[model samples]
Target: MVVENHVPLQRLNTFGIAARAMRLARVRSDADVLALVRHPDWRWQDTFILGGGSNIVLTGDVRALVLKVEIPGRRLVHEDARGWLVEAGAGERWHDFVAWTLQQGWPGLENLALIPGTVGAAPVQNIGAYGVELQDRFHSLDAIDLETGAPLTLRHEHCAFGYRDSVFKHERPHAGGMGLKGRALITRVRFWLPKRWRVELGYHDLQRKVAETGITEPSPQQVFDWVCQIRRAKLPDPAVLGNAGSFFKNPTVTPEQCADIIGRDPHVVHYPMPDGSVKLAAGWLIDACGWKGKTVGRAGVYEKQALVLVNLGGPTNPCTGGEVMTLARLIQTSVYERFGIRLEPEPVVVG
Candidate 1:
């Protein structure tokens, strides 16, 4: 129930951006949040919920009250012949949770290994990798409304999950008009891991691992290990070089659009979706635009992967959020000019 002032945010965010939260509170449980909501002096103030800080960009000092979620726990909620329902606190690290599930004989989350951030942040971004999205294994979640401190439970349908999207990402409601955004604070999340586990090697990286290893029937642990290896080889560790995993979502286009791009550059990397749409590789586009290994104002495109944008200056003298966004906008402008499609940023911007 302690509220602190002038909290340093450099260590909190994976990007290592130098910023300060005017006021910050660490909420380890639902009760802690309720206690804060009932506090006389801070009851009506605007609050920002922070998870692992993996999916955000800090442009400047955060003026609002920051609730740094630190809740913790993991348990099997229910089990049946079909699947096992597991619950984890919002603050649990996502990659560790995935590994823990595998050790406990739950094979469903292995493909999502090595992803940075907290469990609560996963649903916000609908985090996905290697063809498995959080929505695929999600059961339900419990959250506390910041305004009233009232507990709320939402099922999978209530989340309104989409490609790297959820109700949590939208500040304003869409057609259904039920956006949660910054209004609710997730405390716990439950996942449905099926007993009849089938390995997901749909992504090109996983397929390459299988081919390279010559292991046709890879176990869950093997898949998890492979994912970590691939990510390590391709992505720069945040601890060494500050970065937020992928900078942009893979843009989807119609068949005609794909054909048009192919006509212009036949080597363009793209994938055909089940829904008849084409998913164009954002990295390939950025690399094709000659941004890879290039730096703009201390913000640079990763040499190994163009999708990732990194802070060239590191923690000592990190790039400003303004520099990162400037580079992002420049890349977006170039891609749009070349492909006639806009690339949207994946991280949430905080100021």
Candidate 2:
């Protein structure tokens, strides 16, 4: 575990924001993490755990000791008549792992295909797509406590997964006063894929695809391919156009609030939740407020999908985190002013 100095992080993050890590260490195993935590010189230093760097915005040079997780492995740990239990190292690419699971006949994660980032980061954000959240198939995860230098295995209930949130997203003082943000380093993640799998085509795009292709009962690989195609067309490729996928979480509102907004604007897009609340389409709100194709200092709302904020300038002149935040705040203000619902950013912001 060699600690490097002043590592450029422009390519590391999906936003392509120019920044540097003051001190960075690549951790490839549990021993490397233990060694870092047990080291007297580095034990007390502030540290940031980095996975694939797809869900973060670097505002400035990172001052914390950056632990870049590189642990790599994938295997079917257990299989029975009921389902399959698959385990993967935290550093494994999420999309590749999903594809691998499909190839192995573990067909549950097809809806979440094509998402950027590492498997370790999935639980932190409770990443979801097309009505399938990680918690739905999560079995357990192993992580190391940064403060105590002890290992922990957490189950579904222990994670406290919510909409785009988990215990990992908050600090100790927050999250019901027991949050684990920055306090745990995930080593491995295990998924529970049922043997009797069912395809999830609840999203509008997937339904549209089914209508266009006339495939009523699609296989897991077909679903995966469809999701990939939809995402590729809607969201800009991070390699070509720097972005962090969806920029905002779809804000949920009470039924009364939804009715009020509907009364004001009849064309408002919303979905009724199981709990009687209404989930407003944030992208629709932004587009309604005329934000698509808008730019603010090299940062702009994606033309294809208003939910995505992209870097207008290429790698030669990338958008700074400040500019991205500025555009975000402006959109938030507009959406709140127009719809009376405040938009929340989805990505983690750090410096």
- Count of steric clashes across candidates, in order: 0, 0
The sequence of per-residue lDDT tens digits that candidate 2 reaches over residues 1-351 is: 689999999988998999999999999999999999999988999999999889899899999999999899999999999999999999999999999999988899999999999999999999999989999999999999988889999898888899999989888644454689999999999999998988888778999999999999999999999999999999999999999999999999999999999999999889888899999889999999999999999999999999999999889999999999999999999998988899999999998
- Which lDDT values do the candidates have, in the order given? 0.93, 0.94
For candidate 1, write residues 209-276 as lDDT tens digits. Answer: 88998998999999999999999999999999999999999999999999999999999999899899
**RMSD in order of candidates:** 0.9, 1.1
